[model samples]
Target chain A: MGNTKKNDRRDFLSKFGTAFIAGAALSPLISNASELLETENNVTEIKNFKGSFEDLLGGDYTNIKLRMQDDVRRALKKPMKDRKWAMAIDLRKCVGCNACTVACIAENALPPGVVYRPVIKEEIGTYPNVSKINLPKPCMQCDEPPCVDVCPVEATWKREDGIVVIDYEACIGCRYCMTACPYEHRMFDFGEKYSDGLPLVANYDKRPSFEYGKEWDREDRHSSPIGNVRKCTFCAHRLDEGLLPQCLTTCIGGANYFGDLNDEDSVIAKLVSRLNVFRLKEEMGTEPNVYYIR
Target chain B: MKKIFYILWGIAFILGCIGVAQRFMYGHELANYGNRVVWGLWVAMYIYFIGLSAGAFLLSSLVYVFKIKMFEKVGKLALITALVTLLCALLSIWFDLGHMWRAYEVITRPNLPHSMMAWMIWLYSAYFLLLVLETLYAFRIESGKYDGDKLKSYQKKLGILATIGIPLAIAFHGGVGALFGVVAANPMWHSALTPIFFLVGAIASGSALFTLIFAFFWDNKKGEYYQNMLKTLAKIVLVAVLFDVLLEWAELSIALWMGSPEHTAGFRAMLFGQYWYVFWIFHLLFGVVIPVWILATKKNGIAIGWASLLVAFTFIGVRLNIVVPGLIGEKIPGEASAYIQPRLTYNYFPSMMEWLVGIFIVAFGIGLFYLGNKYFKLTKENNSVKS
Candidate 1:
């Protein structure tokens, strides 16, 4: 009986040892082959390897990715309700310094004869009882986005992130979008350059840590495909880096706030909850991103 | 007589060429189009020409489908004018587009359901095809190439097609008007009646234009049939002008009654401000009242011809008033009023390039018209022989 048990133990030990050795041997070979395949495919395997292993180990990277994907899926699955981003302007806080207008123009690198942001000076009452209100206006970035709706080429679209962006390459310069926009925020890029020294401005370079969104070689202003309608992007390029828009940063009166409305703790969320905010042209059903506070 | 026609066409062609050159070199800066007046004379001209095309084609349909033998001489001429005017309308839009090269993208990447202009593109293309087919059928009949049996059979078939084309023409112009009417942003153009008004105006202006063209042909001794044609056309013009007046009055009255500050201000600009004279004297009196009076009261052929000339002349002004004033209103209160005056300091005129291109297109149209007339025997006798 004792002899039989010893033989059995030896057999078990040998089988276990061989299986371990085979696994160990095959792992490197498989990994190396995959690495070679990755090189051939011009893809870095490290990027793919990250979350898969983390998922197996229940790590935070996997959790975050899953959570983000779920959130996106859920948001998309739901019916479009209050999907439009809106802003309320507090007429009480705005001062007629024109800082926001200037900053927006500088950030957008707007050519001569184009103004992306403009402040309207209004007198509310007669001379004695008159209250001067300086209203700074940007592209309303409407939910319905009349500009996007009317673009014949589907060149302009509302992003999942709540900004309307124009694909310069696809736009046909029909100007139908400009005519459709009630806010009149849309502008035609008429191939005007800054060489005439009308206060030359470069918006992207003005920021300290600007990353190019789309690859465009400098020295070709016309390369952006002129004749397409353009408007304020709410500083989408800046937001990608967790930075505020140039207009929001440079507002002398601190009238503008940029934040995620999804976050309850965000400044915009808090202000919207507390203040009586109103959008321009609510009757039009555009559900604009910009709001005004009384 | 042919030499004079050629001379006049040549002059117009040269002027149009100069306009196109100005546009190409300097951009729309040559035109009196700015932020305030984003649409101006070119857009007005586009609508005017489109109206003329639609009107002339509908008249030709009367001869084709209704078998109006008295109107036979002007039928081919109407078709030619319709085709030519359609070309002019297209040229005006081409000039208006900021990126003319990217025009093909409008078709290749069409945004379905949302774009009114895209719908316009498709509708206009279909209408143009219908016009081409109709023109060919007319040609075949006039040339006597088809025997009586074939001609009768073809006419029977084409008459049905021509009937379908009348409503299509109405829809085409009405759709163009709807393009503006649907833009709720511009209150002046946002009325439900806008499409109806556009259709009515189209018929009125179209009849007026045909009257003028026919009278010119008659005066030049092109044919005696034009005199009888003008007499019939005068009655059509009178009715159209009266309807146009009623619609204009109703549109304004509704705006006034609405009592919206923007609508009121826009109406005031048309009635009393910079556009007041254009609204009152040009569009109202000359376009509607005076032309209607002369057409209705005058019996003399020369007087009727002059009345038609007045109608044609003033319709251009009416189109301008329709397109420009609404765009010129305040986009946002407390901001600068979007109104633009036609002064050199504030606005632009069509530069040489713009003129040249415009001339080229007009010349091209006339040249095509002349070629069409020469190749096809466009006379009553020829048409009768085939039938």
Candidate 2:
């Protein structure tokens, strides 16, 4: 009975889309009349499937997106104190496409030399026996962030939700945090532009990055962030808006996962409990929220 | 000779003006130091000048705090050198700052105890205040402002100031080293010996510089008193240099002894990689070996002056060696090749603008010294001010 109900809704949505396209064709003013229409029973077949793109491609995924969306909605229902956000990256699945890196840049409007996520490519063994490993690094957002304690002005701190954030206005750009960070995730903005050699600064290059949900313009040299140290905040702004982090959503291999770790049933919680999971620089005792599965 | 010196100073001043203009007009965009190697020539120079100031101030305390009469004549000179170098050191760091104006936040709203740099700034401020008061009392004593009882009281106050300054100078310079040492991420600088190394290096370089000034610029160079002072200062510099060499050897050999890849990579880069000449040619030969040779063999003031000048100038190389090597290696192997950008590379050299700014700082210091000598009566006893 449940399966039939899902199919009915999926079929109804596809029919509605076709009708809308047909209706638009009757009006000469409508543009791209053919491409606007989508015809596929994949939606109908996977109506019960949640969010992962595997659902569209007929893979037997647990519907990670749908489960995560539900998980997000459920977690949001609880007070902020009960939430502990975490990220898990499965190294075996990552192909080093760097799509997540580019998506993060676009989402954050990061300038040149200010990379928040960089995929480290390494090869093990010798000659023909060699195997490639791609590790994507982001700010650890450690429970005891070394970068936080070294800050001379207390400009950066770990949020209650487990994201380490910087107050750009308060940061003095001493680069102490940059040196203290073992992972070297922090970047100092020297007011460089991607639009160098262009006749003018490109409009897109000048667009404000909405980090921490605050619009920051990079037009001026003396602006808060232009001379401040910057790092990843786990896409905190997107998390608050019921969206998974941009990097997780854009990972082509579905290697990355993020959710509230406080929920025992969440994907991240289950992943963290696995023995294969590990963190970078574990001996440093930073207790980072981001974990990797070997 | 004087005219030629003036001309050279003029040329340097104008060139430095261009660099300073570019710095303010464009910001660090012109500097080659990127995110990975975040500091460069200016930072090295800052530490170098601060080392000079601390070393010279500590030497002056021998006259006031310890009452070593053999060092009496150069006490005022050492004080002035400390003050001037402190200014230059502060300026170098200010220019290096990404936000030059926000530096006061370190004082106004410091995150104390947690930040080593905050402690450094506060200690330097206290040291600066003490220095100024100490200089005033020293001048008042020489300016003939009081009778026997009053003069004795002034001397007592100066002694107290110098005694207080001993710890301030040690803390400030040690704090400079601690600033780098506390960075656990960079294995090259993470050591208990770092602060001790910095303190000893400051004494070595600073005393060498003071000895040179006394040898070359003292008015009564032909007198027996002058010759005796020059000999004693040279001996002091020699001892400091020997101590500094011992520390340098300890730092180098310990890192490279076991051939541990992680521990020795930065040292290897300093010794064998590009710009290796900075450590070998500029520092080892010109800074240490030659100065040590001249100070040991020659009793003449002129020879000591020449040798001490070489040590003083080439100490910049020592400063650079300390800073750049620690940042040369990648934290993770192959990390440098992972991302390719001008500002992302493990390799670094100061940009042309960086060199020009450094030249300007040196020229500015020389010009200030010249003015102080001529008008402030820095080299004269009981000379009246023109005003």
Candidate with the greatest TM-score versus the true structure: 2
For model 1, the superposed segments whose C-alpha errors exceed 4 Å read A1-88, A194-212, A215-225, B1-9, B218-227, B337-371, B374-386
Query: Which digits, one per residue and each the tens of the lDDT, describe model 1 over residues B181-258?
Result: 888888888888988888888788887877876665443344455556667889988888888889988999988887
B274-348, model 2: which lDDT tens digit per residue?
Answer: 989998999999998999999999999999999999888899988898788888888866678777788898888
Candidate 2 lDDT tens digits, A150-232? 88888888887778999988888888888888888899988888998888988888888899999999889778678889999
In Å, residue B105's CA in model 1 sits off its true spot by 2.6
- For candidate 2, give the docking quality class from DockQ: medium
Q: DockQ of each model against the real complex?
A: 0.22, 0.56
Q: Which candidate wins on lDDT?
A: 2
TM per candidate comes to: 0.80, 0.90
Go through the candidates in order and give each one's C-alpha lDDT: 0.67, 0.83
TM-score of chain A of each: 0.64, 0.79
What TM-score does model 2 achieve against the real structure? 0.90
